[model samples]
Target: MTDSIRHLSIHIDRTRDDVYAFASNPENLPAWALGLGGSIVREGDEWVASDAPMGRVTVAFVPPNDLGVLDHDVTLPDGEVFNNPLRVITDGTGSLVVFTLRRPAGATDAEFERDAEMVTADLARLKELLESA
Candidate 1:
């Protein structure tokens, strides 16, 4: 029931566990997830992105698990919620990080493309950071 969905992926020269461990930590999000915000802090059970592009938002992540599922729900100040599907899977000796981006309802072509570009940049940043570590 969405306009479109795009699976953007990046191959990082790091183990799946290593990639997931770093990416799953909300504290490290600011280093790569620019689209999310410039910073995130845990407030009670949910992480709050005070400087998010869409303004202050609450990010609720799924419980940590061995499946490399990094799914999270981002709640905007207006109460609108966006579910982001993310996963890190083993790819040869490295990791393949995949982010599923769903186009917003009634979004224009340019908006969808911009979203995909942002996700791609974030993933690239993750790879660069992890590989350099």
Candidate 2:
């Protein structure tokens, strides 16, 4: 019973490649994704963050590419998996980074909105970081 898919996008005055490269790196998660704000270490084929919610978690990102497909799956310590869909598209002036956020089952409306706001802020942070660089 997940809620609607919420899309939060931010326009950055940077090339699509640059934005995608920076945003897609798991090591750079803390610089933008507030929820996983910590130094991530490689665990075999995945990235693991020990200090994240539910203790340690594993993040497996889609292989980097030029097409701007930035999808990843986060595995919680309790074995729940959250799939995140993200993308970067080039426009005339710059790039558009879009993140798809979904409300987990049983989340209240307020909680869902709060999650959207957090993701919106995170995307804005990523835009600022990239545009400033």
Candidate 3:
């Protein structure tokens, strides 16, 4: 079970398919994911992001599909895996992008809030980029 989970979402002024197609692509990770954007390097079938505060980590995202699932698993240098549950749901004429942020054990309130803020920023960036495209 997770220590705690925060569900953060942002409404994107775009089709669910379009938002999912763009966000679900690993090649586009750095475009919105703040920290990994400049250092996520692809190696064969895997991805490695260098210069992470915790050292280099591997990232693997589920393939994009019609159901709008954008879940991904990131492997820390310590070999711990963090699962991120993300989805794009249709709402009226636009789409809502929801991201689940699981609080790690022993994480302070500040840490958790910072993470939530980061995800919020990332999603906002996604919304802005898509809406203006």
Q: Say which candidate scores most in TM-score.
A: 1
lDDT of 2 by residue, 25-119 (tens): 88899888877756788989889988875688899988878799999998998899999999999977799988899888888999989989989
TM-score for each predicted model, relative to the true structure: 0.96, 0.93, 0.91
Instruction: Estimate the lDDT of model 3.
Output: 0.86
Model 3 clash pairs are 30-37
- Per-residue C-alpha lDDT of model 1 across residues 1-133, encoded as one tens digit per residue: 4459999999999999999999999999999999778889998988999999889999888999999999999899999999999999999999999999999888999999999999999999999999999
| lDDT, residue 83, candidate 3 | 90
Q: Can you tell me which runs of candidate 2 are displaced by over 4 Å?
A: 1-3
Off by over 4 Å in 1: 1-3
Q: Pick the lDDT winner.
A: 1
Alpha carbon lDDT at 58, candidate 1: 90
Candidate 3 lDDT tens digits, 56-124: 888888875789998889898889999999999997899999999999889998999999998899888
Q: Which stretches of candidate 3 lie over 4 Å from their true place?
A: 1-3
Q: Rank the candidates by TM-score, best first.
A: 1, 2, 3
Rate residue 104 of model 2 by lDDT.
85
lDDT of each: 0.93, 0.87, 0.86
